[model samples]
Target: MQRTTISVSGMACDGCEQNVETAVETLDGVNRVEADHTADTVEVVRADDVADDDLHAAIERAGYDVSA
Candidate 1:
């Protein structure tokens, strides 16, 4: 498994955190997801084959910005 920490913007509460987690958890190979609105970060534990772009896209689709 690979763990990735992604910086994200626009998360303001636990609901935003949950939105991000739910989004990322839907991707194939994603084993776990944790989002911290206060930290503006999301940590994902996923299979090595999972692309970072997919993670970014998932967060974006859920209505947030993924930082580079």
Candidate 2:
């Protein structure tokens, strides 16, 4: 498994964090997801086949801004 952490904008509460986490967890290679609105960050534990872009897109699709 690979762990990736990325900063995100627009998360204001625990529900926002769950939204991001749920979105990322839907990806095929994602093993786990943890999003913290208080910290404005999302951490994903995924399989080797998961690409960074996939994570970015998943977060964005959930309506958050991801830092590069």
Candidate 3:
């Protein structure tokens, strides 16, 4: 498995965190996801085949910005 921590923006509350988590968890290779609005970060544990671009896209689709 691969663990990745991504910086994110526009998460204002727990619901926003859940939104990001839910979005990323939908990815095929994603094993787990934890999003923290307070820190503006999202941590993902996923299969090695999961690409960073996919994660970023998922978060973006959830109405957030993934920081590089």
Candidate 4:
């Protein structure tokens, strides 16, 4: 599995964190997702085939912004 850490904006509470986690977990080959509102980041454990664009899109779909 490959681990990726991406910063997410607009995560102001636990609910937002859960939203980010749920969104990322929906992707194929995503093994795990841990989102931290406090840290404003999402850590994804997924297969190598997972694309960065997919991750960014998932975060956006969750109503959050991905920081570059």
Estimate candidate 2's alpha-carbon lDDT, on a 0 to 1 scale.
0.92
Error of 1 at 38 (Å): 0.7
Q: Over the full model, what C-alpha lDDT does candidate 4 score relative to the true structure?
A: 0.93
lDDT of 1 by residue, 1-68 (tens): 99899999999999999999999999999999999999999999999999999999999999999998
Per-candidate TM-score against the hidden true structure: 0.98, 0.95, 0.98, 0.97
| Residue 53 in candidate 2, Cα distance off native in Å | 0.4
Summing lDDT over every window of 10 consecutive residues in candidate 1, give the lowest-scoring window: 19-28
Off by over 4 Å in 4: none
lDDT of 4 at 63: 91
After the best TM-score superposition of candidate 1, give how far the Cα of residue 5 lies from its true spot, in angstroms.
0.3
lDDT of 3 by residue, 12-41 (tens): 999999999999999998999999999999
Model 4 Cα lDDT, one tens digit per residue, 1-68: 89999999999999999888999999999999999999988999999999999999999998999999
Better model by TM-score: candidate 2 vs candidate 4: 4
Model 4 scores worst on lDDT over the 10 consecutive residues at 16-25
lDDT measured at residue 39 in model 2 versus the true structure, 0 to 100: 88
* C-alpha lDDT of candidate 3 relative to the true structure: 0.96
Per-model lDDT: 0.96, 0.92, 0.96, 0.93
